[model samples]
Target: MSADVIADFWPYVMIVVAGWLATDIWRWLGVLAAGRMREDSELLVFVRAIATALVAGVISKLILFPSGALEATPMGLRIAAAATGFVAFLILRQQVILGVIAAEFVLIGGWLLIGA
Candidate 1:
Protein backbone atom coordinates (compact mmCIF):
# COMPACT_ATOMS: atom_id res chain seq x y z
CA MET A 1 0.00 0.00 0.00
CA SER A 2 1.05 3.58 -0.62
CA ALA A 3 1.99 5.89 2.26
CA ASP A 4 -1.27 7.78 1.76
CA VAL A 5 -3.31 4.54 1.98
CA ILE A 6 -1.44 3.47 5.12
CA ALA A 7 -2.02 6.85 6.74
CA ASP A 8 -5.74 6.71 5.94
CA PHE A 9 -6.13 3.21 7.41
CA TRP A 10 -3.85 3.62 10.45
CA PRO A 11 -6.36 5.56 12.54
CA TYR A 12 -9.10 3.04 11.93
CA VAL A 13 -6.75 0.19 12.71
CA MET A 14 -5.55 1.85 15.91
CA ILE A 15 -9.15 2.54 16.99
CA VAL A 16 -10.19 -1.09 16.54
CA VAL A 17 -7.13 -2.37 18.41
CA ALA A 18 -7.57 0.16 21.20
CA GLY A 19 -11.26 -0.73 21.58
CA TRP A 20 -10.36 -4.40 21.77
CA LEU A 21 -7.78 -3.79 24.46
CA ALA A 22 -9.99 -1.52 26.51
CA THR A 23 -12.94 -3.92 26.54
CA ASP A 24 -11.15 -7.26 26.94
CA ILE A 25 -8.40 -6.25 29.37
CA TRP A 26 -11.02 -6.20 32.13
CA ARG A 27 -12.30 -9.64 31.17
CA TRP A 28 -8.79 -11.03 31.63
CA LEU A 29 -8.51 -9.29 34.98
CA GLY A 30 -11.95 -10.54 36.08
CA VAL A 31 -11.06 -14.14 35.20
CA LEU A 32 -7.89 -13.89 37.24
CA ALA A 33 -9.75 -12.33 40.17
CA ALA A 34 -12.60 -14.83 40.12
CA GLY A 35 -10.14 -17.66 40.79
CA ARG A 36 -9.91 -16.37 44.40
CA MET A 37 -13.50 -15.46 45.23
CA ARG A 38 -16.17 -15.85 47.95
CA GLU A 39 -19.78 -16.85 47.21
CA ASP A 40 -22.71 -14.37 47.44
CA SER A 41 -20.52 -11.66 48.90
CA GLU A 42 -22.06 -8.28 49.73
CA LEU A 43 -20.00 -6.46 47.11
CA LEU A 44 -21.09 -8.94 44.46
CA VAL A 45 -24.72 -8.65 45.46
CA PHE A 46 -24.55 -4.86 45.41
CA VAL A 47 -22.98 -4.93 41.98
CA ARG A 48 -25.71 -7.23 40.73
CA ALA A 49 -28.44 -5.05 42.19
CA ILE A 50 -27.03 -1.87 40.65
CA ALA A 51 -26.59 -3.52 37.28
CA THR A 52 -30.13 -4.90 37.31
CA ALA A 53 -31.57 -1.53 38.33
CA LEU A 54 -29.68 0.25 35.59
CA VAL A 55 -30.86 -2.23 32.97
CA ALA A 56 -34.43 -2.06 34.23
CA GLY A 57 -34.37 1.72 34.08
CA VAL A 58 -33.17 1.58 30.51
CA ILE A 59 -35.90 -0.88 29.57
CA SER A 60 -38.62 1.17 31.21
CA LYS A 61 -37.42 4.36 29.56
CA LEU A 62 -37.31 2.72 26.15
CA ILE A 63 -40.86 1.46 26.46
CA LEU A 64 -42.26 4.58 28.10
CA PHE A 65 -40.62 7.44 26.19
CA PRO A 66 -38.83 6.05 23.21
CA SER A 67 -36.88 7.99 20.64
CA GLY A 68 -35.82 7.64 16.99
CA ALA A 69 -38.06 4.94 15.41
CA LEU A 70 -40.07 4.48 18.61
CA GLU A 71 -40.96 8.17 18.73
CA ALA A 72 -43.41 7.57 15.92
CA THR A 73 -45.72 5.50 18.09
CA PRO A 74 -48.26 6.67 20.65
CA MET A 75 -47.04 6.40 24.25
CA GLY A 76 -50.32 5.00 25.55
CA LEU A 77 -50.21 2.17 23.04
CA ARG A 78 -46.67 1.35 24.10
CA ILE A 79 -47.59 1.17 27.78
CA ALA A 80 -50.69 -0.91 27.05
CA ALA A 81 -48.69 -3.44 25.05
CA ALA A 82 -46.13 -3.70 27.82
CA ALA A 83 -48.82 -4.18 30.47
CA THR A 84 -50.72 -6.76 28.45
CA GLY A 85 -47.56 -8.67 27.68
CA PHE A 86 -46.50 -8.59 31.31
CA VAL A 87 -49.86 -9.95 32.39
CA ALA A 88 -49.77 -12.68 29.76
CA PHE A 89 -46.26 -13.57 30.87
CA LEU A 90 -47.23 -13.76 34.55
CA ILE A 91 -50.39 -15.76 33.80
CA LEU A 92 -48.30 -18.31 31.91
CA ARG A 93 -45.73 -18.42 34.78
CA GLN A 94 -42.36 -16.65 35.01
CA GLN A 95 -40.65 -17.78 31.84
CA VAL A 96 -38.56 -14.63 31.40
CA ILE A 97 -37.45 -15.09 27.81
CA LEU A 98 -41.02 -15.80 26.80
CA GLY A 99 -42.16 -12.71 28.69
CA VAL A 100 -39.63 -10.52 26.93
CA ILE A 101 -40.51 -11.95 23.54
CA ALA A 102 -44.21 -11.61 24.24
CA ALA A 103 -43.79 -7.99 25.29
CA GLU A 104 -41.62 -7.19 22.25
CA PHE A 105 -44.02 -8.87 19.86
CA VAL A 106 -47.02 -7.11 21.33
CA LEU A 107 -45.30 -3.74 21.01
CA ILE A 108 -44.19 -4.31 17.44
CA GLY A 109 -47.53 -5.77 16.42
CA GLY A 110 -49.34 -2.86 17.98
CA TRP A 111 -47.05 -0.49 16.16
CA LEU A 112 -47.77 -2.16 12.83
CA LEU A 113 -51.49 -2.03 13.33
CA ILE A 114 -51.42 1.58 14.43
CA GLY A 115 -49.07 2.59 11.67
CA ALA A 116 -51.39 1.17 9.02
Candidate 2:
Protein backbone atom coordinates (compact mmCIF):
# COMPACT_ATOMS: atom_id res chain seq x y z
CA MET A 1 0.00 0.00 0.00
CA SER A 2 1.00 3.65 -0.38
CA ALA A 3 2.73 5.54 2.43
CA ASP A 4 -0.31 7.79 2.81
CA VAL A 5 -2.61 4.78 3.32
CA ILE A 6 -0.17 3.21 5.76
CA ALA A 7 0.01 6.44 7.73
CA ASP A 8 -3.77 6.66 7.95
CA PHE A 9 -4.16 3.05 9.09
CA TRP A 10 -1.26 2.79 11.55
CA PRO A 11 -2.98 4.31 14.57
CA TYR A 12 -6.19 2.33 14.14
CA VAL A 13 -4.25 -0.86 13.53
CA MET A 14 -2.10 -0.27 16.59
CA ILE A 15 -5.19 0.32 18.75
CA VAL A 16 -6.81 -2.95 17.66
CA VAL A 17 -3.59 -4.90 18.12
CA ALA A 18 -2.95 -3.40 21.55
CA GLY A 19 -6.50 -4.13 22.73
CA TRP A 20 -6.26 -7.77 21.54
CA LEU A 21 -2.96 -8.27 23.32
CA ALA A 22 -3.90 -6.59 26.60
CA THR A 23 -6.16 -9.27 28.09
CA ASP A 24 -4.02 -12.28 27.17
CA ILE A 25 -0.85 -10.54 28.33
CA TRP A 26 -2.26 -9.99 31.80
CA ARG A 27 -3.85 -13.46 31.96
CA TRP A 28 -0.61 -15.13 30.91
CA LEU A 29 1.33 -13.14 33.48
CA GLY A 30 -1.13 -14.17 36.16
CA VAL A 31 -0.95 -17.85 35.17
CA LEU A 32 2.85 -17.80 35.18
CA ALA A 33 2.90 -16.22 38.62
CA ALA A 34 0.29 -18.59 40.08
CA GLY A 35 1.18 -21.87 38.35
CA ARG A 36 3.86 -22.68 40.94
CA MET A 37 1.35 -22.59 43.75
CA ARG A 38 -0.56 -25.49 45.25
CA GLU A 39 -4.01 -26.21 43.81
CA ASP A 40 -5.83 -25.33 47.04
CA SER A 41 -3.60 -22.51 48.13
CA GLU A 42 -5.53 -20.12 50.31
CA LEU A 43 -4.14 -17.02 48.61
CA LEU A 44 -5.08 -18.26 45.12
CA VAL A 45 -8.56 -19.28 46.21
CA PHE A 46 -9.06 -15.97 47.93
CA VAL A 47 -7.91 -14.07 44.88
CA ARG A 48 -10.35 -15.98 42.67
CA ALA A 49 -13.20 -15.42 45.09
CA ILE A 50 -12.52 -11.70 45.32
CA ALA A 51 -12.34 -11.35 41.55
CA THR A 52 -15.57 -13.26 41.05
CA ALA A 53 -17.37 -11.27 43.73
CA LEU A 54 -16.17 -7.96 42.26
CA VAL A 55 -17.45 -8.91 38.80
CA ALA A 56 -20.78 -10.02 40.27
CA GLY A 57 -21.17 -6.77 42.17
CA VAL A 58 -20.52 -4.72 39.03
CA ILE A 59 -23.03 -6.75 37.04
CA SER A 60 -25.67 -6.39 39.74
CA LYS A 61 -25.14 -2.65 39.89
CA LEU A 62 -25.53 -2.28 36.12
CA ILE A 63 -28.85 -4.12 36.14
CA LEU A 64 -30.09 -2.15 39.11
CA PHE A 65 -28.87 1.25 37.94
CA PRO A 66 -29.49 1.04 34.22
CA SER A 67 -29.43 4.42 32.47
CA GLY A 68 -30.13 6.01 29.05
CA ALA A 69 -32.62 3.94 27.03
CA LEU A 70 -33.15 1.48 29.83
CA GLU A 71 -34.08 4.31 32.14
CA ALA A 72 -37.14 4.96 29.98
CA THR A 73 -38.64 1.62 30.93
CA PRO A 74 -40.58 0.92 34.11
CA MET A 75 -38.93 -0.79 37.07
CA GLY A 76 -41.52 -3.61 36.98
CA LEU A 77 -40.64 -4.35 33.37
CA ARG A 78 -36.93 -4.23 34.13
CA ILE A 79 -37.39 -6.59 37.06
CA ALA A 80 -39.46 -8.96 34.95
CA ALA A 81 -36.86 -8.84 32.21
CA ALA A 82 -34.08 -9.73 34.64
CA ALA A 83 -36.16 -12.51 36.14
CA THR A 84 -36.99 -13.86 32.68
CA GLY A 85 -33.37 -13.66 31.68
CA PHE A 86 -32.33 -15.65 34.73
CA VAL A 87 -35.05 -18.18 34.02
CA ALA A 88 -33.87 -18.47 30.42
CA PHE A 89 -30.33 -19.05 31.60
CA LEU A 90 -31.45 -21.80 33.97
CA ILE A 91 -33.87 -23.37 31.48
CA LEU A 92 -31.23 -23.40 28.76
CA ARG A 93 -28.79 -24.97 31.20
CA GLN A 94 -26.78 -21.79 31.60
CA GLN A 95 -26.44 -20.91 27.93
CA VAL A 96 -25.54 -17.23 28.32
CA ILE A 97 -26.41 -16.20 24.77
CA LEU A 98 -30.04 -17.19 25.13
CA GLY A 99 -30.36 -15.40 28.43
CA VAL A 100 -28.96 -12.17 26.96
CA ILE A 101 -31.29 -12.38 23.97
CA ALA A 102 -34.31 -12.90 26.21
CA ALA A 103 -33.32 -9.99 28.41
CA GLU A 104 -32.83 -7.68 25.41
CA PHE A 105 -36.18 -8.72 24.01
CA VAL A 106 -37.87 -7.80 27.26
CA LEU A 107 -36.15 -4.41 27.36
CA ILE A 108 -37.09 -3.52 23.80
CA GLY A 109 -40.69 -4.68 24.32
CA GLY A 110 -40.92 -2.49 27.39
CA TRP A 111 -39.44 0.49 25.54
CA LEU A 112 -42.03 0.16 22.78
CA LEU A 113 -44.96 -0.05 25.19
CA ILE A 114 -43.73 2.93 27.13
CA GLY A 115 -43.30 5.00 23.99
CA ALA A 116 -46.79 4.11 22.74
* lDDT of candidate 2 over 1-90, digit per residue (tens): 999999999988887778767668878888898877887889888888988998989877777788786666677888788889989999
Report the lDDT tens digits of candidate 1 across residue range 1-116: 89999999998888778887778987898778667566678777776788799899998998888888778788887888788778878987877777778878888898888774
Native-referenced Cα lDDT, model 1: 0.82
Q: Model 2, 34: alpha-carbon shift in Å?
A: 5.7
The residue pairs found clashing in candidate 2 are none
Give the alpha-carbon lDDT of every model: 0.82, 0.84
Off by over 4 Å in 2: 1-39
Indicate the TM-score of model 1. Answer: 0.60
TM-score for all models, in order of appearance: 0.60, 0.60
Question: How well does candidate 2 score on lDDT at residue 113?
Answer: 80
